[model samples]
Target: MAIKEGLRPGGRSARVQDAIHSAVRALLQEQERSTVTVPQIAARAGVTPSTIYRRWGDLAALLADVALARMRPDSEPAETGSLRSDIRAWAEQYLDEMSSEPGRNMMRDVQASATPGYCVAIIGAQLQTILDRHPHEAAPSVDRLINLVVAPVVFRILFSAAALEVDELHRLIDIALRLD
Candidate 1:
């Protein structure tokens, strides 16, 4: 589905795009990001390599679009009245998704893309859309709560050597909310 103001293609173009995206997603599941190639994607999609090149210009663009599509549907933020509950629910949802197999695979691909700028552009749009939906609170405490839900976990994902446990995450959320 398209976003509120995003453009959506139609007709054969749409079909081809759908096919290519499905194929790329399937390929990511089967292989690592370093091993995916246009020829492989074409074979998986049951289309010629030329078709992919013509439609997407390159594999990175195609993969980025697929990732954006995968990430878009779950972008809705939780709306519990308390900032702690809301941010915990929202961050946990994001963390759960990112820790899943598909999410990890897509992240690997995004990290490896030669044209990461394009991938960033699409993913950033999705993040912005989520932020827009939530509409940040003015209270400093609420801002910290939101930041706790988002920033620290993201930092862990990028820098920590150990795997994250949900309990630890919940604790982080608790600390963020100042729930004692």
Candidate 2:
């Protein structure tokens, strides 16, 4: 959804957004995604169908918006003493999540949106946070981390019909850190 400039996020707008998101999440859990419709979401969200159409243009966009929200990192990367250890931990977790069935589904849904790199930016920020923790050690740029680790992991999960093993993820991390 395109954000409206100057709109306060804590009023009727925020409440409606939250309600709509919650309604979508609940409906997805209860029914097949193909069965979900604008009217259904509107009724469940306590809003008019026009509201959703106006804000999201259609159901696909709304679902994509919801998927983006879910893909965002909910916590900081794990804190380990060394940069390599921290990156390894983060990469392993990333591989596990993005390789899961639901995770792959979320990635597919999020790809439907106009701003696909939004999720990448979120991941890059998280990687940078881990890199920032170890100032004394040389670290790869966040973009490098994503290119060397995230990109390959995502490719394997979505295209290869298999997840990267921990050993493979470690090798990717080593390659990423080797640039330093």
Candidate 3:
């Protein structure tokens, strides 16, 4: 999503969002997810229910916002020299993180959110960064990586009972890199 020019972290708006997101996270830890209410989150955040309604629309959106925050890359992808190695390493790491129980829960929350495209954008940005590292190689575009790799990994994480394997990720990476 296009962040408003002035709404970055440390601003009042960002502070409020952080507080609300923190509140939801804390509440989920303390009680059942289904039992957490808007008023409860608002009370915990020191904001009114209207404030959350105006900003996030509903509980699902708020949870999704938190999930998105959790999904953001904390560091750059591994610098493994070649495009194929870099992508395989990154995909394997991505699968490992997203296949865990908490990660699966977060993915499900993001799926239920109205701004699901943000998830794609987050993944795309990471791939773009990797692609940028190999300027001379005929690597796949970020869009192709998203379509041929990340999307399927995310799908298996959220839906399939079996965890996505690193070898499978390697195969997907090969397919993505081989594409024109």
Candidate with best lDDT: 2
Candidate 3, 35-59: lDDT as tens digits: 9999999999999999998887888
**What does the lDDT come to for candidate 1?**
0.63
Q: 1-180 in candidate 1: lDDT tens per residue?
A: 211234456766677777888888787778887789999989887899988877667777677667767765553565666554555566677777777667665565556455435534543454444445545642224355446655565556656664467778888776754534
Worst 10 residues of 2 by lDDT: 1-10
lDDT of 2 at 106: 78
Q: What is the C-alpha local distance difference test score of candidate 3?
A: 0.84
Superposition TM-score, candidate 3 onto the true structure: 0.87
lDDT of 2 by residue, 1-180 (tens): 744667798888888888999999999889988899989999999999999999888888898888888877788999988999999998888888878866887787777767756887888889889988999898888888888899999889888967888998899999999964
Which pairs of residues clash in candidate 3, taking residues 3 or more apart in a chain or in different chains?
A: none
TM-score of each: 0.64, 0.94, 0.87
The TM-score of predicted model 1 comes to 0.64
- lDDT of prediction 2: 0.86
